[model samples]
Target chain A: MTLLLAVKALTQENRDFLAQYDIDVVTPDTVTDDQLSEVVISYAWDNTIGNKILSLPNTKLKWIQAQSAGVDYLPLPLLAKRGITVTNASGLKALPIAQTVLGYLLYFARGLNVYATRTHWEPFTDQYLISELPVLVFGTGRIGQQIAHHIKAFGGKVYGVNTSGRPVAGFDETFPITDYQAGLAKAQVVVDGLPGTKNTENFFDDHFFAQFNQLFLFINIGRGTTLNQSALLEAIDDSRVKYAALDVTTPEPLPHDHPLFERPQILLTQHTSWGENINAGRVGGLFRLFEKNVPSFMKDQTFIQNVVDLNKGY
Target chain B: MTLLLAVKALTQENRDFLAQYDIDVVTPDTVTDDQLSEVVISYAWDNTIGNKILSLPNTKLKWIQAQSAGVDYLPLPLLAKRGITVTNASGLKALPIAQTVLGYLLYFARGLNVYATRTHWEPFTDQYLISELPVLVFGTGRIGQQIAHHIKAFGGKVYGVNTSGRPVAGFDETFPITDYQAGLAKAQVVVDGLPGTKNTENFFDDHFFAQFNQLFLFINIGRGTTLNQSALLEAIDDSRVKYAALDVTTPEPLPHDHPLFERPQILLTQHTSWGENINAGRVGGLFRLFEKNVPSFMKDQTFIQNVVDLNKGY
Candidate 1:
């Protein structure tokens, strides 16, 4: 039996992440139908080919571990029919996403970008005190919670929204996904960390963007589909959202000709938030589980801690 | 009969902040000495005529308030000799400084700038996790303690150096400011937030920056004189320190010829971190001491909260 690590590309760190175990690794295109006895799949978010290839595999494909957290784009139907075990590198990316969101918030809240271009390096003006500013986090998952914690530490008021509406530890307020409008009204800086799912597709449309008053900074560390690009563009035109910090976009590697590329208010980051100290090493705990043939330190937990329920879709 | 507000150049917001009360505002350059008894006195850090004008008899300066936290540059001896009440806008700037320090740690500990310039938008490989990263924070004052809270929240191993070495609430490891060399060995990113005084000047010299095995980031939110610019530039050359975020620089409004301005690794901010909204509508708390003969919030205390110990040179 052979083990296949089917990823678009592997970094030295990614290889090191798998090296502890004796699994053989290959790209998705190289996996033969017969060699699926034990396959571990990995792909960047847009690796549609990897999804299709896994669906064509036999029962030997025991587990389909996604290289990313979002699985809506994965061929879920085929995996469900085959009863294949799927794990995602979800929580592993939480730290980076949280850091990125915090960075976006700091850049604005602390006004780093505003002062960066000035010849007079001291901010005599252009200061918006954080303690008075309001921040709304769209998702209360690991990333959202971490961001909320940092915001709270800064003396800013923090509000969060989650599917369950359960209280997050540090947020001043929390609401269910249903009270989105109320939450939006209370926060000037709206941050999106919600997972991309059917329930949240195009969640930030014209109506949502319009509800927000002007001069707010819109940040997306979550999947890009949550925002209606057209609506966001119009809002930018209308000066509703004064700035946009995008880490993930509806389409990866935004085309050079895209108008969004030229917008001064928008600061685009290639979806590389999760790459620092690349997360390949994070899966070492999983390898230790494989070696022991045991449930792991936490017992059958997802590669990242939180398990997203596929039935309702995260 | 006249009143004066001896404040820095008044912007619309500053004017609005003071206009709430009925005091007419005037600068040293605008006032005649004979009418001083009818006016309040305030001064920005760079008020060139502060010493010359305040020396006038019958300037009748009812009170002297400083727009700066550090009043050493002012003709303090002469003002004190005149029995003029002096106070500073210090606490008002803590939030912005604390916020900037937090950004420096999170961004550097997480390698944000590195990934931004990378060709592969995918993450770079890494072996160890951030849990292994060690961060040292200097100064345990209002801003420093706030930073420690954030560092610990993010799972960082935090060590701090303060004057007393007394255990701070959030720091896991602390050493007296004198014993920092041993602690510096463990710090990948050392944040300098100590106020400038005799003991603290040129604190980040060649010997200080040379301790780090890995290139790290340095954040300065305190006075710029505290960090020897010559030493930090040397660190950049030796690759001991990778980048720096300086909210204050020695001789602020850093000269155009300053080496820091030309270095991509250096982030020199205008000394404006403390003036944002936190100070707004709050300074009058001190103003009430005499303007209306109202007792201070800390009326019985020997010193106002955050009052600098001039002997200690803060």
Candidate 2:
């Protein structure tokens, strides 16, 4: 079978791993129209190259593997129509993203950010004990569950919110999205881990933020489109949201003049949550996950892990 | 029996609690020369008024309960010569300070401080996993042990340095100050939790910092005098120390013009590590420790907790 590798550059180890399979690997520059017709699988770095290959007429692509967890950029309807099985690197980003979430929580709890911006010695009285703060995480997927696990390890009570909220492990309580008002009211910190989808778009608007009675810290490590930026700014102004740490913003490389950059209460992290140590063996994690599922896909066009539902948009 | 209360102001609850005792509680303004002669016990907020009370001739002070953990400012020689029992609020600051240590650790591990200072979106590459970083903490006393406990809870390996190399409950490995080279070499993050003393003063000087072969972050939550400011700045300049987080600096409220203020690699917290949530009931933690020991001291001239050795100077 033939496969297309559209990542930046595959490590020699990854290349060697693919060499073991009886497959012809080709890159976008090298693949001809005839070669594209023979491509049975594609390992995509992003939707840009993936869409180009998909647009080729009479392509024989059977499966598409996304390097990133979020598949919002993918042409889901077209892929579903073409009967292409799509898998994503979901659990691979869990640990690093979870660590990032903890970093934001502890940043606010210890009041380090406030003191970092100060020029004089003034005691900050707004610190909270991480062990006592109640956290409400929006999504119970791999990233959200991992965030909850870390928070729970630190003695923070975690409440998970999902569509069905069918009691996920590592959460003290789980509430369905429709009934999360009580959870939202009690949470001292709210974490947005929801992926970008039709259902999740603008999920945290003014109406949603108005549900909070007490001042709360909001952290968004998920897709930025899932949150309403204007509403978040308003919440910060009204003191409904005490602070915000946004790793992902609506537009990446947010325009230099974006007002969020000027807000001291908001920390924009430039979507660096997935930047784990290069020496920590994380570079191979996604490839390993792909390798594990390859056998299942080869046997019967079935994915053993992280298969995205085209209609659900995750 | 008479007890001099030289704190700024007593909470109504504290005053009511003191009222239950047979001791005559007098504030600094209320206590006169005659009353000084009757002052057999004292709960001091700092050395300013406590030293004055002790200097008075024909004074009857026998025991001093310091509200702060660090008693370096206390006249140790006079207290030791006079045979006055000295107890301090050592363990009281442990939780808050430990939380602060975790704040610094997570801050660097997640690059929040770097992002906080940035005006644009640029990914920071120096992030590390807290669970994988080896931490070396100086002075395994109440504060150091508490810092180790929190680090251990987060799966970080903690190496503690003490005078005797005696095993501490929370540390994975314990080393004496005489043999800390190996620990220093392995440490990715070095935390100074040592108190100010003749032996520890300027202990982390040029030679001590030169032992680090790899890039490391240094955190000072301990007394500022224990660290050599010049050497710390030099280390940061040469890139031997990648980052420095100082809660206490030499001559703090470090003049705004100090060179350390200009370096982006350093984070001066203005000594806010002890800032805990006022609503978290920390106001009573130290007083509660004092109350638990008060009855025993009154009945038998025996101290129950945190009795400081004036000769050692912690």
Candidate 3:
């Protein structure tokens, strides 16, 4: 089987690991206008050119192995029409996202805000801090599950949101989206780990936010498109949202004069998630595919880790 | 059951909560040298005068409850002589510390420093972010434990240090001070959450830092005395340490021109970890004692959530 692993850079150590197999490692940029028979795609696919790349090899391409946990960007129609099997690296990103979410949460919960607040001469320096606030996580995917586990360790009561009412580990309670209103109703901190899709878009709009019982600590690390920025801004303006941390913003590289940047309550970090250290794993996976002569998910098009449904655009 | 909640401002609602019992609420200023015998004492006692509150009711006090988790300031000899029961609010600060540690970890792991090194812009942004760094957490107390737990949640290998060699929940490995040599040997991120005792002070001196594998993030959410600032400066100068975030500083208000302030590696934020909100929970602990004769940590004495060995000065 001819296996193709696409990534930015592969380390010598990783290259040696893949040398054991018969695989051709290529850069994402290398997969140009011409499509290959079997290609394992990493996260570096440029949105504008990604679909075109997938369409090039219609009959020959067997599968597309994705390196990201989020499947939203995958060229679903091309893969579907060509019958290209797809899989993803969903589990890997969860640990990192969970860590990132906690960073934002703690930054907010710890009152890091006061660090920048003005005080006379100095502030009241105390030894003991307050209790952990209850967290209501709005997603039970890998990211949510991992986040729940960490929150539980902090002695926090975690309520998770999922499509089904099935119980999830690490969460005190898991309710369906039907009960999402109640879950958010009691949440002191609301985390939107929900993958962005047409259905979930504008999920935290004006009406949705109005349902929050108290001033909410809203964090969006999932996808920017899932948010209704205007509504989120309104929540901030209305005082219903105490703090909003957005790791992903629509049309990123938010204008230097963006209104959100000026809002003291909002913390804007670039969409720095997922793009972290891709070369190592992507390269390693490629090496493994080539040497093992493994019928990679890229060739089979049946087994994928993070597959985005084209119809839903997630 | 008279409780004296010592804080700058204690609320009527909290006062009423304690008043349900027979509590006589008093602020630090209201407690004249006389009415000491009739009440129990509690204070936002991390300040310089935390222990002096004990002297007001030097003889009559049953318990010296502290609104702080660390009783480093409690006069050990005095409390010991009077047999004044001292208990603290240890776990309360866990949430914020956990949050702070994770924030720095993200900042450290993701190379947010590169951006921070220059302005918050790019060309620098193209640098890669690595997430798999090992973190060494000193002081396996509640706050430290929480920090370790969250670090692991982010795919970190957590190593810890504490007085006892007991196993902490999230640490992959822990070493008692007797094994300090072994523990410091493997840490990249050294967090100081240790109590500031004579022995603890300057614990992170040259010799201590020389053992680290490579210090990337040096955080002080605990006592500043835990580190020898001079040794730390040298470590930074020689490139042994990368970043230092001091939430608590020695001789705080650190003289604007202190070596640490201007250093690109160190981020100073006064002593503001527990400064999020001075809500009722903080001052209420002391009031709880005064109102109902309940100690902050009586049920779990030996390792009361916030137990401190005053003789050790932390």
Best by DockQ: 2
What is candidate 1's lDDT per residue for A1-314, written digit by digit as tens? 23655454555655665555545676656766555444543333344645544655353554555556677776666666665555555565676667777776666666665654454444545556566668888888777877777677666898998877789888898988887667777887888886788888999899888785684689888889999988988999899888888788867767667777667667666776664553445455334323332134124422443333556554
- In terms of lDDT, the best-performing candidate is 2
lDDT, candidate 1, at B180 = 88
Give the CA lDDT, 0 to 100, for residue A13 in model 2.
Answer: 75
Candidate 1 — what's its lDDT?
0.64
lDDT of 2 by residue, B1-314 (tens): 45656464556777777667767678877777677667777776556667677778877888887877888878889999998988888988787788878888888888888898788767686677777688999988888988887777667799999888999899989998899886777788999988888988999999977866555689999899999989988889988888889988889767877887778888777777876666436657767777787778777888878899999987
TM-score quality measure for candidate 2: 0.94
Native-to-model Cα distance after best TM-score fit, residue B158 in candidate 2, in Å: 2.2
The candidate with the higher DockQ, 1 or 3, is 1
Computed on C-alpha atoms, the DockQ of candidate 3 is: 0.26
Q: What is candidate 3's lDDT per residue for B1-314, written digit by digit as tens?
A: 56564564666876666556556777666666565445555544544344454545444555665666666666767777776666666676676566666666665465444433232323322222324566778888778877776666556688988778778888999888888667766776778888767787788788876755557778888787788888888888887887777777777767756777667666666766655455665556445533343433333322233345567655
As for TM-score, the candidate ahead, 1 or 3, is: 1
Regions of model 2 farther than 4 Å from truth? A2-8, B2-21
i-RMS, each model, one decimal:
4.3, 1.9, 5.0
TM-score of chain A of each: 0.80, 0.94, 0.82
Ranking by lDDT: 2, 1, 3
User: In terms of TM-score, which candidate is strongest?
Assistant: 2
Q: What local lDDT does model 1 show for residue B14?
A: 49
